[model samples]
Target: MFQRRKVIGVMGSGTQAHRERVIPLARWIAEHGYDLLTGAGNGVMRTAAEAFVAVAGRTGISIGIVPGQATARGYRPRPGYPNPAIELPVFTHLPLSGKQGQELASRNHLNVLSAQALVILPGGEGTRAEAALAARYRRPAILFGAAREFRSFPEAFERLATLEEVCDWLLGVMR
Candidate 1:
């Protein structure tokens, strides 16, 4: 019987790539055969997808939750979405993000709910909202980055300073 691969969501800034931190984590996730899930815009999302797809011979693929909006011309993908690295784009009509990420209409809801686990990186309001949704939904998650970066974030998610610790947590959660 075929089994579905677990998806590991990486949430972070849509403007800052955070490459030094996201690249290795994405590679490790791909190397381990877990599908990578992201917001599919830019910054951490694009960086993570790029790294994940660059892994040679990896079975896992990059999945992006693309946000769109309804207009007089019908729904259209928001600007800068699907950032070239996404191999599997799951587009949605929910455009609200940032401060409204937790709202029902936000695509952040889909990003949080679709993944089996999550790794949160340095980000802004939208990332914070994703972190909140992760906690609210009880998904296994870890804040991976410097503590200072998430000073204003929720205290519920355990924060890890290194990728090694994050990997360990992922192994435990996945098992």
Candidate 2:
């Protein structure tokens, strides 16, 4: 599917994202007119969604790729789970995943494939895994706020110290 709007995937820690950097980056993504795609679980995703919704005159969509069935296993869309700002919530019908990771692998695939680029922030194993997925998918991605240790498939990812550099690169590439 060819999206008319540029979709940028922001990958980072779901539990412990850097508030100062992530929040501003979220707002910037909205302000710059780029659609955002995320796992939409919590933490970084929620922070970005909230910031995007706060900005006025944003010409972007906040889409969440949720994992789980719509009804099976008592799955239901909640207001606060994916944050209240997501305009398009996609239910993957996989499973709520992190460690026991089959569903996570699927969710990760969708997350990487849906976007034109990925912005990686500070994170743990899961974040690392997402980076790897981006590499495998040959998706343009960058790692911010940390060292570039993950083995990129093509080994061409950029490592930036500040969020501004990351944002600049993403905007340039996507635009």
Task: State which candidate has the highest lDDT.
Answer: 1
- Which candidate ranks first by TM-score, i.e. highest? 1
CA lDDT, every model vs. true structure: 0.92, 0.75
CA deviation > 4 Å runs, candidate 2? 1-3, 70-80, 100-105, 148-156
Per-residue lDDT tens digits for candidate 1, residues 50-89, read 9999999999989999999878999799998888989999
Error of 1 at 74 (Å): 2.7
Models, CA RMSD each:
1.0, 3.4
TM-score of 2: 0.83
lDDT of 2: 0.75
